[model samples]
Target: MLLGEELRLIAYNTAIKHNITTSMVHKGLYQLGVSGCPWKDADIVEALGDLGDYGVHNLFAVERIARISEVHPYSRVKGLLYHSYESLGVKERDENGEFIAPKLLWKENFFNRNERGEGNAP
Candidate 1:
């Protein structure tokens, strides 16, 4: 499956298991500086950690998390994304060059990729 599809599945399953909205998962991801592109395993891990830090536990089964993690291994994606963002000279960072999380903007339709013709075949 495509990475985006995998991510959406993880997010959807996580939200369903936690009885929370998909926006909640997106909020957590946003807080972790995820920009919905070039995802890495670390991004997923950090996003999950952000949710856990906010007391959102048991979002998904351990087996599911493990499977996703195995599929998306931690690599240079974060650095690559950061580099691309930096090349644009965007000032979305602190003095330390660390990215600053953007404000939460919930877009409920983000989870409805199928209706939008952006979904992958199952």
Candidate 2:
């Protein structure tokens, strides 16, 4: 809450130094498009770029479920994190084999029986 303009300016300059743009930044205070799968094709750095575009500090702060759920309407914090990284704005690919808003990087939970159409009630 204390992110002064100086820090914002530093962040902006860092973004520019790293080649991030303005329109690409998302004001996630509104939590729009905060749903979907974390990308599976890019590395952590690329994923951080995408998160940066969303106005996240890239400090990798893993908030509690209650806190994150306040921002994202998801059941699990992990799910919300996945969705957050997956919702970045994408643009046409540049000539460096890197996507403007690169995809996320994570593993799929194929063994989660809950999502496999199973129930506990008899």
Over 1-122, each residue of candidate 2 has an lDDT whose tens digit, in order, gives 22446435544554575444433322221112122222221222233344454444422321211133333333233323434333522223457966444222222332243357542211
Q: Rate the local accuracy (lDDT) of all candidates.
A: 0.44, 0.33
| Model 1 poorest 10 in a row by lDDT | 61-70
Q: Over 4 Å off in model 2, which ranges?
A: 26-122
Candidates in order, TM-scores: namely 0.30, 0.23
In order, how many clashes per candidate?
Answer: 0, 1
**Could you tell me how far off, in angstroms, the CA of residue 63 lies in candidate 2 after the best superposition?**
15
Q: lDDT tens string, model 1, 24-113?
A: 555444433322333444365444544444454432322222323233443533222213334534455689978655332224433455
Clashing pairs in 2: 39-104
Candidate no. 1 TM-score:
0.30
